[model samples]
Target chain A: MSALITCSHVDFGYENHDAVVDLSMEVEEGDYFCVVGVNGSGKSTLVKGLLGLLKPTAGTITVAEELKRTGIGYLPQQTRSQRDFPATVCEVVLSGALSRRGSRPFYSSAEKRMATSAMEKLGIQSLQNHCYRELSGGQQQRVLIARALCAARKMLILDEPITGLDPWAIQDFYGLIRHLNREEGVAIFMVTHDVANVVSQADKILHLQQKALFYGTPSEYEKSPQGRKFLGGGDLWE
Target chain B: MGVIMEMLSYPFLVRAFVGGILISICAALLGVSLVLKRYSMIGDGLSHVSFGALSVAVAAGWAPLFVSMPVVVLAAFFLLRITENGKVKSDAAIAMISASALATGIVATSLTTGMTTDVSSYMFGSILAMSPRDVKLSAMLSAVVLGLFVFCYNKIFAVTFDESFARAAGVNVSFYNILIAVLTAVTIVLGMRMMGAMLISSLIIFPTLTSMRVFKSFRGVVLSSGIVAAVCFCIGMTASYRFSTPAGASVVLVNLAAFSGFWAAEKGIQRKNKGERRL
Candidate 1:
């Protein structure tokens, strides 16, 4: 019912480069916010700003104080380097709950239970002891999603989660995400290149182009000129 | 064999074996993360930095460990900075610092009179030289390294795997990265007494790479590296005693042999897998 995150006139930049400028948006509780943008449109930077990783060069951003306590789970886009990391699925997944463990040196029994439950939820319990690199792309994504689930209670911020998945795998991923949003009530703020199918599912669409271009419901996005131009005038998801 | 057995009873020889084992285990544990992160050369750079500090300390007639330890740790921290946020790239920064420090150490050694023997002892290393005080220091610091490493294992794993994701999840990536560099500096300085400045980085490189040849998981590689490093150190120390060779060179030679053996084993396994696929 209340806003979970708020960004007002935020400008995020790295030295001599402003990736995001005057961006303003809010993610409400239970909101499935999909941010769609072209290359170098500051989508990742905006997410970083929201996640408190990047400080705003201007304006302000606020994350709920309570959510910061339990911690937000982040699923970054799988990079080539991450794919080569020599970690077991259990090890990788266990690290997802690291922020929640406080100054305690090791993972608590409850944290291990959370990791196991997350893996089971993502149907990756069998891969717990297997090496992460040995898994297929779809399977790896599933493991990573399970890992993210281990870190949070109500929300997830996924950066290009289905980047390398096959079409069928993408559909299954979408189905799984939809289930999380609808069934488990987990809020999702996903950065995606896939703008079509998500149009029908997203509660809000924030189209970013070096700035926030559109911030409204999906129905409004469909009617807006910028949305029509970006979405190619027809439903491409079907 | 009887003479060697009698020699082993000497307190210094016992200290050498105990201190060397602790040093090797510490080096292997830290080396796994450094190897995985592609920062293995930082160990070499930090070692050279320690060599420079030791040379200066010896030239001034000060305690070498006291002088070198902090300097090496600071250099490691500086390297972390250069790699993490500075303009210079990580590998280039390592090379530059190592070269400059080595040059300084050489010049400092030449400037000091009647110290070539002292310089060689540090440069080439001799396990027989570890006094009780040195052994105690090595053990104390090594225990710190091992304890912190195990305690922060999950945090370190997360930081190494996806630094950006870890930071986003509220993990202090820089803190852990700095922790690793500091631990490595300590290990290198202590190991310089066992493996020598000329060859110490091998302790940080060989074991992890050898383990990676046979293992696919991080824990697997860390555990295997610890075993490989200890085994090689033992064999090397024994060979050094038996053949009267330089300690550092012997340990390095043993590690090189282990690396080659692992390489051959990995290749053989790959070939067998290929054959099975063909069938």
Candidate 2:
């Protein structure tokens, strides 16, 4: 598969210190690349760099031209404040398309159609007018996923999306994301702690703790010494 | 009825209504974004800054509008900056600026000596204080706020909901955040003549919060906030005129009443939903 994302020796950080140092990885087309790491491992920061939210102090991140503008829909880590934000699902989902809507202050008909389609795709059409905060965790995640989808058709970057979900919801969410990756053929770059499900479905795995510990196909990762140590002897107990 | 008509015919009352409505609309415009971003306290802090500048202007025999406007706007921007980048947290920054400005205002007022009535009037906001020139200035600033807000509605919505996501989507989050702060500063300054430094922030807070009891969409909140603000101000102005009550306090009370009613009604609805689900 061809590479859609090419990060060459990237170093990213905040003002005082670097969180990610000399990390290089590639997200191949239709790749379910799961980034597994411990807390404070710079996984979210790396996602920020790739999304162009944080500028790399050194090295390069090249996204394909077609997927550059509104091409990589991002579902950022849902925080406590955002969970209670006073906005409807429609408004929240519609905002994902703002980057591509250009100078128009009002949402265009086509953009509205895109939002509707995204909501339908996630089976959240009925919840369009509902307050986002009032929804269940699973439902809220679906709305967020629809929002990300509205922005980009080619790829999704989900950052710790299942942080607040219950077991049943997590399973449902995993099924949906896997379905999106396999059936819709959308490349997914996920930063997750769910080692079992992500590793099992992932085409590639990049184990990180400030730097790359392992980078290979899931099967290859299963045999690696570092992966065995990290993944508890490569047993997918969950 | 004849007395009410006579009051309406007075030019100062007309000016009050004109300027009050304009300021109310503009405040509502900034209200949703401000309250949502958890920067509602910034409005109160900036209003205190305006009071300090106003007292300085009064003591120095300067134009209050000219003296207070730039200072308050600068304070607003500074507050935004320090809150975002500096070591001090936003609430603490607001508290420091608020206390310091209030202290400065009280000291300046004490030095002025003879203008206690004017200073007191500013503190409580006399409806008669809104001159024709004040009306014109507020009208012009209101247009600018309305124009910019309408032109950048989508971008502002994105920034309000998620700054990181907005930044990732290439929305210039910093610029928009600063823009919201600046507009809020302008609203606080303009509304202070009718709403007072002590009470003007209610205009910046009440409408959006009251609307949130019912509407979930950002657009819904904006529209409803404007309507609620305009209606409450009208009622407050009319009641204050008829009863000779303090206009600023009257308007704030009106807003408080609306919020109380909405809150109760929301509880009722939730209770009803629970009942239905139980059945």
Candidate 3:
């Protein structure tokens, strides 16, 4: 399948410190690709490079479409900033719609309807007016997901979307990601530390160890050496 | 009461009172967002920068308005860009520039001789020194800040809460952040004549902190902060006039009183609620 996002021999760093080195990967259209890695594994760096938030220190990166300005929804790691920020859910969701169409004087009715529909799709209609900070961790994730849904152009890029959530919340979050992928066909590129929890839902798995170690279906990842190590040396429990 | 009546009768006194009211309202409104986003130091830094600029203008015999406002606004722009680019931590940039600005103002003012006629008034604030020009400028700034806050309140809230979320959703977080910074610059510029550099940050921080203790929602915080600030300005101005004290100190003292009152009342209510539940 043709790729929606492609990174060719990319090198990225921050403040003269290299985070990722000579990495290459591809994200196809309609792919729910979960990027799994240990802490400081440059998972977030890869996502940032892909989103053009951080330009690669070396090599060429290209996407199928003009991705720079087009709607690429992002869920950052620190959700507290969004939580304590003084904005209602509807206003936040409408921002997603705005990102898709930047600098527009106003949002059209259709865009408003789409944002509302996205919120409803995420089953957060009642949260439309709630202050984001007041919500539980699970509810906040759903709201952020809804916001991403409003703005994402055929794909969403989330950085550890399941952190600080309980098991039920994580399950529900996974369910929501799956629902977005299966029912709506929105591609997902999420960097996750909870490899096992999200493994079942991830359509394609991209395992990173400072480089693209494995990029294929979950079953294929299981056969790879790193994946075997990840799964506790083929015994399945570590 | 008689002294207050007499002070209220004077037009300049009334003007200063009104000016303080307007300034307090705007500062408090901006403070809500600033404190939430941890940009309280921005207010402090800009106030110092403006103080320096005003001192320069005074020493150079130029209109303080033209010199101070632009300098602080430019500083605000640079501060926002630096912080947003993640080149320097926001607070660090603020401390560096603000300290330098304060030092520059002190040195410049000290270098200029023969203008010791109530310079301390400007240093500590002399609301009574506010001319018609100052009142008009304060009113204009208050109106602009209030108008922009209304029109872009939603967007500003979005950006302040989560710039990434706002950017992801399609909000131009950079522009909004700059807008907030500019507004803060304006607020500090106008506030310098009344609140002074050393005490102005409290005008931005205390009202918000007090309101946060009592309010549960965004709207509640904004409205309550505005009200509390207005009252503080009024009482502070009156107290300064009656007691022949520094207007800036009076205003801040008034704010502290209001804050303490709110805190005590909130605690009292919570204790009563607990006792009722126990019963």
Using DockQ as the measure, the top candidate is 2
Q: Tens digits of per-residue lDDT for model 2 on B31-114?
A: 888888777888999999998998888788898889899999899889887767764477887888998998898788887775
TM-score of 2: 0.94
**Could you give candidate 2's per-residue lDDT for residues A95-125 as a string of tens digits?**
9898787777788899999999999989999
Ranking by DockQ: 2, 1, 3
Ranking by lDDT: 2, 1, 3
DockQ-based class of model 2: medium
- Which interface RMSD values do the candidates have, in the order shown? 1.4, 1.2, 3.3
For all predictions, the C-alpha RMSD in Å is 3.7, 2.7, 4.3
Q: For model 3, how does the per-residue alpha-carbon lDDT over B1-279 read when each residue is reduced to its tens digit?
A: 898889978998888887778878888988888788777877888888888888878887899888888899999888776665664476787788888987787777778853474356556776765678777977988888887677666576667667766755556677777877888888778777777778877888989989876665676788898999998888888788878888899889988988899899879978998999999
In candidate 3, which residue pairs clash?
Answer: A85-B161, A95-B169, A96-B169, A98-B170, A99-B169, A99-B170
Q: Against the hidden reference, what TM-scores do the models get?
A: 0.88, 0.94, 0.82
DockQ of each: 0.61, 0.72, 0.33
lDDT of candidate 2 at residue B174, scale 0 to 100: 88
Can you tell me the CAPRI class of model 1?
Answer: medium
Give the proportion of true interface contacts each model preserves, from 0 to 1: 0.73, 0.78, 0.33
Worst 10 residues of 1 chain B by lDDT: B81-90
* Residue lDDT tens for model 1, B1-279: 775586588888788888888889888888888878777878888988988898888888898888998999899889888776753477887898898998888788888765567788878897776778778977897888777768877777778888887887678888888888998898888889668997889999899999988787888888899999999998898888888999899999999999999999989988998999999
Tens digits of per-residue lDDT for model 1, A111-173: 899999999888899989888887988889988888889989689999988888999999999
